[model samples]
Target chain A: MDLSLIIMQLFSGIALAAVLVITALGLTIVFGMLGVVNFAHGALFMIGAYAGLYLASLTGSFWWGLLLAPVLVGAFGMLIEFVLVRRLYGRSIDDPLLLTFGLSYILVEGVRIVFGSDGIPFPTPPQLIGVVDLGVGFFPKYRLFVIALVAVVLLVLWLMLERTRVGLIVRAGARDPQIMRVLGVDIGKVWLAIFGLGVGLAALGGVLAGPMRSVNPEMGTLVLAEAFVVTVIGGLGSIVGAVVAGLMVGICISMVALFAPEMATIVMFALMAAVLLVRPQGLFGLKGRA
Target chain B: MPVYETKSRPAGLSRRKAMMAMSAGVAALAMPRLGRAADDTIRIGFPTPLTGPFAAEARDQVKCAELAVKLVNDKGGIGGRKVELLVRDDKLNAGEAATRTLELIEKDKVHAVVGALSSAVQLAVNEVTRARGVIYVSISQSDTINEVKDFSKFTFHEALNPHMTTAAVARQTLKKGMKVAHLVADYAYGHEMLRGFKRAQASIGAESVGEILHPFGAADYSTFMPRLMSMRPDVLCISNFGRDQANAIKQAVDFGIKQQMKIVVPVILHNQRLAVGADVFEGVVGGANYYWGLETQNKTAAEFNKAFRTANGGAIPTDYGAYGYSGVGSLLQAMQVAGGTDTEKVVAALEGLQYDLTKGPQHYRKCDHQSVQSVLVLESKKKSAMANENDLFAIVANDPGADEMLRSCSELGHAT
Candidate 1:
């Protein structure tokens, strides 16, 4: 293989990883903080893409869609948490799982009914339509934008979690909700905000991804599986773990695809299995978290 | 709220008389109506993926089939017996396709079966329909289905096989010593298309630089892009269907591969072209079973297009959707020619039956029951050239059902 080709492939892998990181981050936070397995996370991601596409068409600007899609979808997520997910908090673990699984079907079907089952094209913004000539090879400008955006999101997320009072309470609540309540914090409200934030991240990922992939009702089905794999391989709730595992899975898939293309999809599952065998709680998960 | 006395009955009848009438109506509605003898209607089972990656295409197929049914009934429907279409969703899985096909045969008692969109799903449907001696007109492209092992007297292929379409496409596109590479979907359809392309390449003296097989419904093709770029082939042959095709082409353009080489798809879908828009698809060459632009050249195609548009809010019939129209139209035409819906009579009537319901004249080859029809070589129109949103392709070339383009009988393991 040519050295330049290898360099390009590695960069492509990182571009893929950027998408996985953002999507998986949502799943990890919701699972970690709320202890609810959000099977509808993929549906939320799909809804975000549709919402963005609809808004972009309505507003006549891709930027408006980008700015408003996550906010709108986040508000929707907050409503879901309040009206439906809140009722399942004290119930069996399977309750939320089953509820979200059914919710996924309803949401996907709802989109199908409204938008039709066909994939709708979302064009890359005019500013990002062309390629950027990297030293090794040319890459799509939109993809480069996505990678930079994800890096910025990670930095902002880190700063907010480590420095802000809300972040402190969120972190403390994830560790021990009862103690936070005893300390005069409204843990219920905190959970609602966290769920909103998590799904908002998913929506952001969707908005970014629409131009790259086909935007359809079932678009989230495969991504949901891939996101779950990333979340599992990363520790259940560890944010940094998601970043590392996302990149690892992405690179593994890309390299395997180069040599043995048939094994690309399977390689990620193999990585997850290998990781679980060594540390069942995931790469960065605390002991007993699983 | 006002309430009536419990014992009072309506002026029309007494309570006992009403109860008796209602019971009789319930019994009549509940009675199981089985077989063509119960009601003088010909039931044809139409199964396609309704909820998977191919849902949009499948829905279009259903629409086309419905149009065919309506056209037949409008014309008095095969000797005054109405036609009934029993539709089912195969869900794009082989197992589910088999199960749905069985139900269509046993429960619905359809005289014939039609419409499985995916190559693998069609085979599963063929297995069930062929065993029961039900006439099955498959509208999916696949080479293996035409082989002696899979072909049956009752099996009729209304869609062009991979060999025919690829040969038509390759002959039109390939040049001597040109380098070609393939990105194939890892399934029956993809493998057969690659084989067909390779055969065509060998005949044209083109060099096969590289080939990579990716899983079906693969969302990302970036991982394979680097290696493909490294190959530096003159043409990149993408052998996938549905969203996979759209994504691969979109990403190939994204990676600047389009600037280096031509991209050729074995099968290009109308709905997919519309969804992805004309910009990404521009200049891409491929073969199609039907193109609405053929309306200009063929009277039958013009009529079909007008009827389809009238029924579907002015949307043109898709390539795969045309298969549904042709498949059901041909089957019903055969029944009319035979003067009845008997399996043997219909089979005999369908063999070598020539008709031009859509896309000009076509006939089912007697040797393998494969539809001998024109293959359209289409080029995606530039955004500026498109007259309307649906004017996505310009017909570059037309292979008008030349016998030489199809595989010989012996080659398909059929006795000459």
Candidate 2:
């Protein structure tokens, strides 16, 4: 491979990794904090894509879709948490898992019914249509924008989890909700907020991904699988682990695609399996977290 | 308030009844009639992907089938039996298609089965219908369908196989000095397409610089874009259908690959053109099994086009639409010619049967049962040049059905 080609592949991998990081972050947070596997997370992501597509078509502005889709999806997530997920909090894990699994199907089918089965064309805006010539080679400007936007989102997320009083409470809650409750923290409110935030993040990822890919009902299926793999490899609840594993998985897939396109998707699962074999709790997972 | 509500009961009941009637009307419009039992009617089973990735195309197909059935019914039933089409949604799954084939054959007891958009589903359905000696007419293009192992006396393909379409497109596009890179969907259909293209390239003395196989429904092409750029082929051949085709073409445009090399799609769909938009497809040369623009060239096709547009809110018919129209028409014609709906008789009738539909004249070959029809190589017009939304293609090359373009009988392993 030429040097410039390798450089281009690296940037492409990073752009892909950026989307993975944002997608997996939400799954990691929800699973890490709530100890509930939201199978509908993928469906929520798809809803976000549809929401963004519809809004963009209606408003003729991708920015408005980006801003509002996540907010709308997040609000819906809160409602879901309050009405369904809240009751299953102390129940067996299977309860939430089964409930969410069913919800995922409903959401996917509902979207298919409303939007039909064809992939809605979510074209990249004219401003972001061209390529940017890096020193090595040209890269898609929209993809570069995706990477930058995700980086900004991750930075803001890091600040939220590290700096604010609420962030401290949320982090502590993820570690020990019972202890936090005993320490006079409002655990219910914390759970709702975190769940909403997690869902919002997934939707944001969807909005960013819509222009780059076909926005359809089944669009989230691949994302959901990738997000789970990233979450598991990164260590279930570790934000840093998600960020690291996401980039690693992205680069691994991209580089492998350059050589063996068939193995690109399979490589991620192999990486996750390898990580599990070496460290049972995942790379960033706490001892008892798994 | 409840004690005095009795006087308004009639008004409230009527109002509720009115709401119910309105809701029922909307529901009726929403649900497409799959089948209806009519006195003394010949029933035919039609299975297509009514949901999933191919749903949009399936709608066009079903519309064409409906139109064909309507046309037959209007002229008094074929052999005095009203042609009733029983439609089933296969969901693009092979298992579902097989199950539905059995359901349509056994439970519904239809005289014949028509329509399959996916090659995988078509093959599965073929197996089911073949075993039962049920007449099967496929509208999907799959070279393997005609292979002796898969071939059956009862099966007839209405759609042109990959060999025919690719050979036609390649003959028109490939030249002595052209360098081609192939981005094919990694599947049976893609494999057949690549083989056909390679054969064409070899004949033309064109070099095959690179070939990349991407998984079906792959959204991003960035991973392969850099390598393709480096290879710098004169043309990029995309061998994918529907959503995959649209996504790949759009991404190629975004990466400026189109500027560097000419892109040729062997088989393009109606929805795909609409999805990718005319701007991206500008100056691209491709081939279509059918295009609504052909209505102007053929009279029968024009009638179907006008009927389809009237039914579908002025949307022009796609190749899938034409497939459904012609596939159903051929089935009926076979039955009409045979004078009955016996599987063996219909098969005999369909063999070497020439007919005219939305497209011009076409015939099913006696050897492989694959349709012999004109392969249209289209040069996409600019957005400004298009008179209507569906007016995307300008027929640049019309390759007549040639025996050489089709796979030899020996190649398909069909017993002489």
Candidate 3:
């Protein structure tokens, strides 16, 4: 109830929101552009963490992991798009969803087979090991870094989507793929790149999250569900919607946890339901977009 | 030719008669095979979660149990019959555990059932095994399992329950007038641990500041961290297990809550410490059923450690892994004493049975079948002090007063 405590709680919510935004961004973009509901997004996130852990060990630097994990996982995503996802494009919307669902299981089981089920420790970078005196209260430096990193990512994403030619094609494709095809956009290649980028963003979220949470085979299962909730609440394909909804859900959970810890997990779903009842297309979703 | 004609005479008989003769022959062949299987091997059903969040601990348990089976076989087997292990994945669900236990009983015809990792899962397994009148040696921590309502004559608890563990831990750490807060996982095990801690607090006169119940397998604890910090308690008692414990502790450290208050987990797992790293777990104290470090002091522990290391590529047995080893090892030993695997006789042999397979001296309490053994109070070693990756904790205390720590039989609703 203290003002300082409330301020600290708000900061904690932002830190949580940072994680949600980065993770849900991938799902939003994939659904927005390719019209594919990727059930494998969570597995990709897990692979990203594992990839980061392995790469950090091999290169002896967490920085390299932060740099290369997303790239490697993104390449893997591109491969998946080429081999399996590409064939399902013109088919039933359920085709890609089901394929990705099965893909998630295979990826999780495959990781279990290779790495075993034990959670591997991913240490925080030495520089971010301690707490920062935030005037109201002390907070973990790593968390502040995450918040800042998410902001940078959001800005870069906004500039790219708004200013770059690739962004125009992606937005156009999302609106009308046939028009882009008529405009000689080669939408297939654009879809592949967008898939890779979306998956890479998910990997980035995983790498950032590994230090804060356990990195294991089933680590992504819960995150996947929460990410879905965020995407749905934000309007499935809206990047801006994901960012706004992520913050709203994060604060809602943290505030609810302060009063009733038992209802923290349920608060997000309740918020989503409330939003959908009033605006069926989500907060930022255009009419008939879903 | 006469012999052939004699044989052919039955064949030349009515076709119905020949079919009946063949059917009888097949029944005679199949009946003995089932009888021979029962005669040749003593099957012990091992049900535990091998697919969920706790799969790592469960798999280690299977390995430890396998080692026990191997040791029994090496010792000329149990009454000259081989001990067979039937392992099943309970999937960490109570319903799944009950179904698997039933299959192990009805289909596999296991003589005894051993192994369940979670407290809730074990209760479900106990129900199935008890109704079937089969011996069940539960390797999970649960206070409810020993109560008269859930307890059965055939049920035996090999792992230390939450009461013994929490009381032992609290006695060593808590003091008069200290402010304490509890972060409990909302489950049977968590609630039991909370009860134990509250009892300890009542005796010690520690002030209860706040209590928060989080869902099991929660991915983020940050939402609850600010609230916990707001309470500003002197000590925080975390009542959770497996990945939940690991994440809670890690996040507590992340939020700098460790600097504000001491964190005590009622039952800290070996795998959790390894997964979270020494730095995050440093200075956190808790009770463990077994610590491999006990080998230095207890000869029996040393022997068990040597054998376990030899069989497991030198990897030491974890706290829960020790449960698997001791649970199965003691059951087989009781069978050896009873001369066979009869449920009544083995049950008798197990009651008041004394052994030191992993931890120091231990025995099964006659009243509730709870394993009366030492609870090792362990403090996670600092990164600099750790000799190896496996050397995670330093034993602070080895309390042998387990009998005193248990709830009285009358209190457990058992007739005194």
Candidate that scores best on DockQ: 1
Error of 1 at A62 (Å): 1.6
How would you encode candidate 3's per-residue C-alpha lDDT over B224-315 as one tens digit per residue?
Answer: 88788888999999999899999999999998998899999998789999888999999999999998988888888888889999998988
lDDT of candidate 1 over A219-250, digit per residue (tens): 89888999999988999999989999999998
Q: List-wise, what DockQ does each model earn?
A: 0.76, 0.48, 0.65
Rank candidates, DockQ, best first: 1, 3, 2
Better of 1 and 2 by TM-score: 1
Q: Model 3, which residues run further than 4 Å from truth?
A: B1-36
Per-residue lDDT, model 1, residue B219, is 92
The lowest-lDDT stretch of 10 consecutive residues in candidate 1 chain B is B1-10
What residue pairs clash in candidate 1, if any at all?
Answer: none
Tell me the lDDT of model 3 at A126: 88
lDDT of 1 by residue, B367-401 (tens): 98888889999999999999977788999898888
Alpha-carbon error at B115 in model 1, in Å?
A: 1.2
Tell me chain A's TM-score in each of the predictions. Answer: 0.99, 0.98, 0.98
What is the lDDT, from 0 to 100, of the residue A246 in candidate 1?
A: 95
Off by over 4 Å in 1: B1-32, B35-37
Q: Check candidate 2 and list the clashing pairs.
A: B301-B358
